[model samples]
Every structure is written in structure tokens, then in C-alpha cells.
Target: MTRIAACQLAPVPDGLAANAELTADAVREALAQGADVVILPQLVTTGGVLEDAEQARAVAVASGHGVFAAWAAACTARQGSVVVGGFCEAGDDGQLYNSAAVVDATGLRAVYRCAHLWDRERVVFAAGSAPPPVVDTAHGRIGVLVNYDLRFPEWTRTAALAGADLLAVPVAWPAAQPGEGGGPDGQLVAAATARLERVAVACADRSGPGWTAGSCIVSASGQLLAAAGPGRSAAWADVDPEASRDKLVAGSSDLWLDRRPELYDRLTAPRSTSG
Candidate 1:
């Protein structure tokens, strides 16, 4: 079992220095608590600045530079732990993506771009066309599904089918979006976890009235393990990847049941001209 921690923070807008410092503080806190893996919210650097694309791109860092690399070194020095956090990337083509990086001893492990950009994100960031959940870590196979990926069941299912024992989500879930107010994230999270019984960590920004939307971690059996609200707070969960796989094979552990794929496909099928 690996001890994991999620940092849910209210990041200051465009304050790169302070943001990095605050984020580092949370990482240290998680390490102090014996976390072998720590996950942080999406867009930790510049907040949710969808209006200013250039500014967003300016803050974007390459895989091996800046805060992401620093965190990786810290984790490696501590105990060869893994760290994940959302960020923007200035690609070689000069386009930027809403990305999340998996950090470890050697530096960045895998960088995932947000495939499903929500609302105004399309303007500030280019949509990532790749599917998620790359299983390339020392601890075990872990998948990354950034914010807005939560709205689609197929994304999570795709990861589960691809052999992800654990799924980590970095979100900026707003307090008032849809049924999100008053623990809606928990219910949605439980339902999603129940679909593919893998330990999931959804680290969200403590945003409301403009940014950050708290965070939560759910067990494989649709149970809300821990959650945090607005402020620089974090939560810890012990995840057993082998046990996660074992739970799926146990049948009654609530992994991959009641998934009505045929029904969805039929509904999505285009109407025939015969009508």
C-alpha cells in the first residue's frame, strides 16, 4: 500500500512566486504525513486564467524546468515518491496545453494534456486529442484524468479498460457548477468509482466566484475517503494497487457492473435514411 496525499488549494491569480511557495508548502505537509505519492489540483500555477491565453502560455513550463522539476527532486530525495500536479506547457510548436505531469526520481514521468477542454478553456489552451491513463510508474500503474474529464464516463472507463489500477484527477471544479454545490463532487465521484473500482484522487482548486473548487478522494467501492474545502489544505489516502486489482476480480467489490454500453451506443448511433 502506498500512502497518497492530495493538495486542494486556493491559488492566487497570476502570482507565480507565491503560488509555487504555497504549493511547495502543501507538498512538504504531505511528505511530513508519510505520503509516498502526492497529487495536486489542476492549474496550480496561474489559477483559471482562461481569458488571457498569452499570459497562460507565459507561465507554462517545459517538462524538466521550474516547479514541476523541483517537486520531482523533492519527492525523490524524500523517498522515491511520485508527485502529480496540473500545469500548462509551451509545446515546441509554440502552442500551449492544459497539462498534468507525473514527477519522480528521474524527473517528469509522463505529461498529459487535457483532452476534453471545458467552457472557455478552448480559447486559452489547445485541446489534447490523446487518450489518458499511462501506466509507467515504479509504485504501480497509475492514470491521469485532468479536470473536465470527469464529465465524461467514457474517459474514466477508457482508463480502467487500459489497466489502470489507480486514477488521479486534477480539477478546478467550481462550487456552483451543476449539482456541485454541497458535496455533489462526492456523489459524482462515488458513481464514477463504482463504475471502475479503482482508487481515485480528485484534487481540485479551492475556486469559486471565479476559481478553485475544493478536492476529494474516493475509494474503489464508491466511498468518499476524504475531502477538502477552500483554503490551502490537503487529504491523505492509502492505496493498495494490488488490492485494487484484487477487488475487481472479487466480483462483489463493485467494479465494472451495470455499465450499459450497448444502450449508449444505440442512442448515439446516427439515424438511418430508411426512416
Candidate 2:
């Protein structure tokens, strides 16, 4: 069983130093609770709000250096727990990306650039064109999805099809508007996705003034295992990676074996509009 920790942080807007410190504190706190892996909210290292794309690009850092070095050190000290979190990444092509990384005692294991951009994000960040690789870790085969990626069924399904037992999501989810469901959109989607994909999912979301703070850990069967309510908190859960591999829905209804992929060619075809 893999014990996972999801951290809900309320970052100080535009305060990088304070955010890093807060992140470290959360990591330590999660570790103290016996977490095998810790996941933090999107852009927790440098806070989510930025003046413009220029500011975001300027603050982006390379993996395994600076802020990442500190996070890696924290994981190394724990000697086992893998830490996954989001940040402003300086890509190899000199562009900026909203990215997430997985770190363990061995060092940086995987990095994922958010493929789906949300609202203002498209103006400040470049969307990733490819799916992130599934990482083989001590706990399980881990995959990463960013904030808006959760809205795309194909994204998570792709990860699960690639044998990812766990999906770690780092998000800065906004609260439901005045007349909405009074619950964050992330909550329902996370649960639904986990149920459909049969993969254990952990989402770490930022909590603050206008955010919903809907961080949660879901079992392979889509059960809400743990949740961090409306404040800065940590949610923990124990999951068996192998359990997700079972594609059985009932007596003889298997998820994977019953696939009819041959008829799914249209899924990849571009749509045409009527003139």
C-alpha cells in the first residue's frame, strides 16, 4: 500500500520566498504523518498570481536546481517519500510552462507540462503537446495531470492506458460562483474520473480567499478516501497500486478486455464544421 499526502496551501500572492518556506513546512508535516508520497498545489513554489507572462517566464526555474533542489532535499531526508508538486518551469526551448515534477530520494523522476491551459493561463503559458511519461516508482507507476487536464477525459484515460496506477494532480482550483453547486468543480470531476478510470487519484489544491480548497484523495473504486476541507490542511490515504489494474467492473464486464478500439478511429479525427 502506498500512503499519499495532499497539501492544501494558501500562498501569499507574489511572495516566492514565503511560498517556498510554506511548501517545505507542509512537506515536513506530511512526512511526519507517515506519507509515502506528498503532493502539493500548482505553482506553490512561487505562488499562482503573476502580473504577466514576462513575470512568469522570469521566475521559471530549471528542474533539480534552486527551489527544486530544496524540495529534492526534503524528499532525500525522508529517504523514501516521493514529492510531487507544480511550478513555473523553464523549458529546454526557452519557453515557460506551467509544470509539475516528481521527486524522490533518487532525484527528479518525472516532469509534466500542463497540456490543457485554462482562461488566463493561455496568455501566460505554452501548452504542452505531448502526454507525460508514466514513471516507475517505489510506490507505484505514477502519472501526473495538471489543473485543467482533469477536464479532459482523454488525458487521464491515456495515462491509465499506459499503466499508470496513480494520478497526482496539482491544482489552483477556484471556488464555485455565487449560485453554483457550492462545491468546487474539481471535486465532482476528480471523483468521476477516478471511478471511470479505476485509478487511485490524489489532488492537491490551493486554499485561500476565493479558492474552494477541494484537495482530496480517491480510491481506485472512486471512493473519497481523504479530504482537506476549507483551510490549509493535508489529506492522506493508503492505496494499493495493484488494485487499480483490475479492469473488472462486475462479474464479467471488464474495462480493458471489452474495448472496441478499432471503431475509435473517429476519436482521433479532426472535426469539420458545416459551411
Candidate 3:
């Protein structure tokens, strides 16, 4: 069983130094709790919802930023431990991207940029063209996805197909308004995604004004193992990543073997105006 911790934190806007320490501390704390994998909220190094592209560019850091080195140092406390967190990335191509990095004792392992932008994010970030990366780690094959990317089934399916045992999601979900049904709760969406792909999922959400503090860990069977309560906290759970390899859901119902990919051509086709 691999222990996972989803840390929900309130990052200080534009305070790189402060948020760096905040995330590094969270990693150490989660590691102390025997967590093999620690997941942090989106834009953890820089609070979410930037004003414009210029402001985002000002705060964005390359994947090689020292903040990740801090996280790597924290992971060194526990051998083979892993950390996944989001940040504003200053891409080598001179564009800003909302990206996440996977780090372990060895240092930064992989980086995944958010592909599906949300609302104002489109104006601040350039959507990534590459699919979510599945990193091979000592704990397991970990996949990553930023906020808004979770809403696309095809994207998550692509990760599962790439042999990701667990999906670590970093999000800053917007809070629902009074008298408004907040579509589907982020936690519920995480659970549903796990159930659909037969993969475990850990979502670390941010807290603050206009955000939902929803952090949770779900099993491959879609069980809500642990969830953080009100305010800043961490949700802990022990999941069997190996169990996800077994695609057999029931007697003869094999999740992967029953796929109908040939009929999914329209999934990538342009949307039709008239049904």
C-alpha cells in the first residue's frame, strides 16, 4: 500500500519566497506522516487567478526553479518519496504555462503543463499541446493533471492508457455562489474519474476567497478514502497502486479489453453546429 497525502494550502499571491517555504514545509509534514506521495494545490508557488499575461509572466519560473529544489530536499528525508505540485511556468518558448512538476530525492523528474485552460486562464496561459506525462517512480507510475483538465475524460483516459496507476491533480476550484448548484463537486469528479479508469486519484485543492477547499483521495474502486475538512489541511489515504493494473471490474467485464476506440473518431473531430 502506498500512502498518499493531498495537501490543501492557501498560497500568498506573488509571494514566491513565502509560498516556496509553505510548500516545502507541507512536503516535510506529509512525509513525516509516512506518505509516499505528497500532492500540493495548483499554482502553489503563486496564488491562482492572475490579472493578465504580463503579470503571469512576471511571476512565472522555469521548471528548474529553486522552489522545486526545496521540494526535492524535503523528499530526501524519506527515500523514494515523491512530490507533485503546480506552478506558473516560464516556458522555454517564451510563453507562460500553468504547469506541474514531479520531484523525488533525485530532483525534478517530470513536468506537465495544463492543456485545458479555465476561464481567465486562457488569457494568462498558453495551453500545452503535449498530453499529461506519466512518470515512473519508486512508489508507482504517477500521472499528473492540472485544474480544468480533470473535466476532460479523454485526457484522463490518455493518462490511464499510458499506464498511470495514480492520477495526482492540482486544482484551485472556484467556489459556487449562493443558491447556485455548483455543477459537480470536484471531489465527486475525482471519484468518478477513478471509477471510470480504474485508477486511484488524489486531488489537492487550494483555499481562499473564490475557491473551494476540496482536497480528497479516492481508491481505484471509486471509494472516497480521505478528505480534508474546512480550512487548510491534508487528506491521507493508503491505496494499492498495483490493484489498478487489474482491469477486471466484475466477473467478465474487463475495463480495457471492452474499449471501442474505433468508434471514438468523433471524440477528436470538430464539434458539429447542428446535431
Candidate 4:
């Protein structure tokens, strides 16, 4: 059983130094609770929503930023422990990106830039062309995804196909409006995605104005293992990453073997105006 902790935090807007210490402390606290995988909210190093491109670029840091090093240091407290969290990245290409980094005691393993931009994000950060990366860690194979990336099933499927045992999502989900209906709940999406891909999912969400503080962990079987309700908190769960390797959903019904990829050509095709 691999213990996972999804931390819900309220990051100070544009406060890099403050958020760095806050997130690092959260990681240490999660580690002390015997968590093998510790996940933090999106843009944890710079808060959830930035005012504009200028503000975002002001706080953007490179992948080699000391904030990731702090997370790496926290992982050293627990053997084989891994941490996944989001940050505003100053890409080497001289562009800003909403990105997430996978770090462990060995240091930063992979950094995935968010491919699908959310509202106002497209104006601030460049969308990543690369697919979500699956990092092989001591505990398990972990995949990284940022906030809006979770809304795209194809993107999450891409991660699962890459043999990710667990999907670590760092998000700053918007709060549901009054009378809202038919909208995707972050927790519900996590559960459905786990069921569809047969992979465990952990989502760490941030809290503040216009944000939902819903952090949760789901099992490979689509069960809601644990949840951190409103406010800053941490959700804990013990899941079996190995269970994802079993593609058998039922007798002779393999999730992977039963795929009809040949018919999925349209999934990558250009959008059509009609039909």
C-alpha cells in the first residue's frame, strides 16, 4: 500500500517567498504522516490566479528554481517519497508556462507544462506541445498534470497509456456558482478518470476567492479514498499502485486489450464545422 497525501493550501497571491515556505512545510507535515506521495496545489509557488501576463512573468521561475530544491529536500525525510506540485515556469525558450514538477530525494525528475490553457491562462502562458510526462519513481510510476489538463480525457488517457500508475493533478478549480448544473466537479472527474483508466488519481486544489478547496484521492477501482473538505487541509489515503497493472476489469474484459484504437483516428483529427 502506497500512502498518498493531497494538500489543500491557500497561497498568498504573488508571494513567492511565503508560498515556498508554506508548501515546503505542508510537504514535511505530509511526510511525517507517512505519506509516500505528497501532492500540492497548482501555482503553489505563486498562488492560483495571476492578474495578467506581466504579473505571471514576474513570479515565474525556471525548472531549476530553489522552490523545487526545497521540495526535494523535504522528500529526503522519507525514503522513496515523491512530490508533485505546480509552478509558474520561466521556460528556457523565453516563454512563461503553467507547469508542474515531479521531485523526489534524487531531485527533480520531470517538469510538465500545462497543455490545455484555462480562462485567461492562454493570454498569460504558452500552451505546452508536449504530452504529460510519466516519471518512474521509487514508489511507483507517477504522471504529472496541471489544472485545466484534467478536463481533457484524451490528455489523461495519454498519461495512462504511458504506464502511469498514479496521476498527480495540481489544480486551482473554480468554485461552483449558484444554480450551476452539468459542470464537472474536480472530485467527480478524478473518480471517473480513475475508473476509465484504472489508475489511481490524486488532486490537490487551492482555496481562495473564486476557488474550490476540494482536494481528494481516488483508487484504481474508482472509489473515493479520501477528501479534504473546504479550507486548507490534507487528504490521506493508502492505495495500491500495482493494482493499475491489472487491465482485467472483468472476466476476459481487459481494459487495455479491449481498446479500439483504430477507430480513434478522429480523436486527433481537426475539428469539423458540421456534425
Evaluate residue 74 in candidate 3 and report its C-alpha lDDT on the 0 to 100 scale. 98
Per-candidate RMSD vs. true structure?
Answer: 3.8, 2.0, 2.0, 2.0
lDDT of 2 at 253: 93
10 residues in a row with least lDDT, candidate 1: 204-213
**Across residues 1-275, which tens digit of lDDT does each residue of candidate 1 receive?**
77778777767777777777777777777887788778888888766555768778767777666787678657755666888888777777778888888887677788889999988888888888788856567666788888888667778778776767678777877655544545656446544664455545445454556443456667665566776655546666776677556544555644456556667786557879998
lDDT string, candidate 3, 81-118, tens digits: 99999999999999999999999999999999999998
Model 2 has an lDDT value of: 0.84
Any runs in candidate 2 off by more than 4 Å, and if so which?
177-182, 273-275
lDDT of 3: 0.90
> What is the C-alpha local distance difference test score of each model?
0.71, 0.84, 0.90, 0.89
Per-residue lDDT of model 2, residues 1-275, tens digit only:
99999999987766777777888788877887788889999988778676678888767777755566667777765656888999888888888889998887667888899999988888888898889668888889889999999989989999999998999999988775321444566777888999999999999998887777888899998998987778548888999999889898899999998989999887788777762
For residues 49-125, write the lDDT of model 4, one tens digit per residue.
78788999999999989999999999999999999999999999999999999999988999999999998898899
Model 4, stretches more than 4 Å misplaced? Answer: 177-184, 273-275
**Residue 28 of candidate 4: its Cα lDDT?**
97
**What's each prediction's TM-score?**
0.83, 0.93, 0.95, 0.95
Give every collision pair in model 1: 205-212, 205-213, 206-212, 207-211, 207-212, 207-213
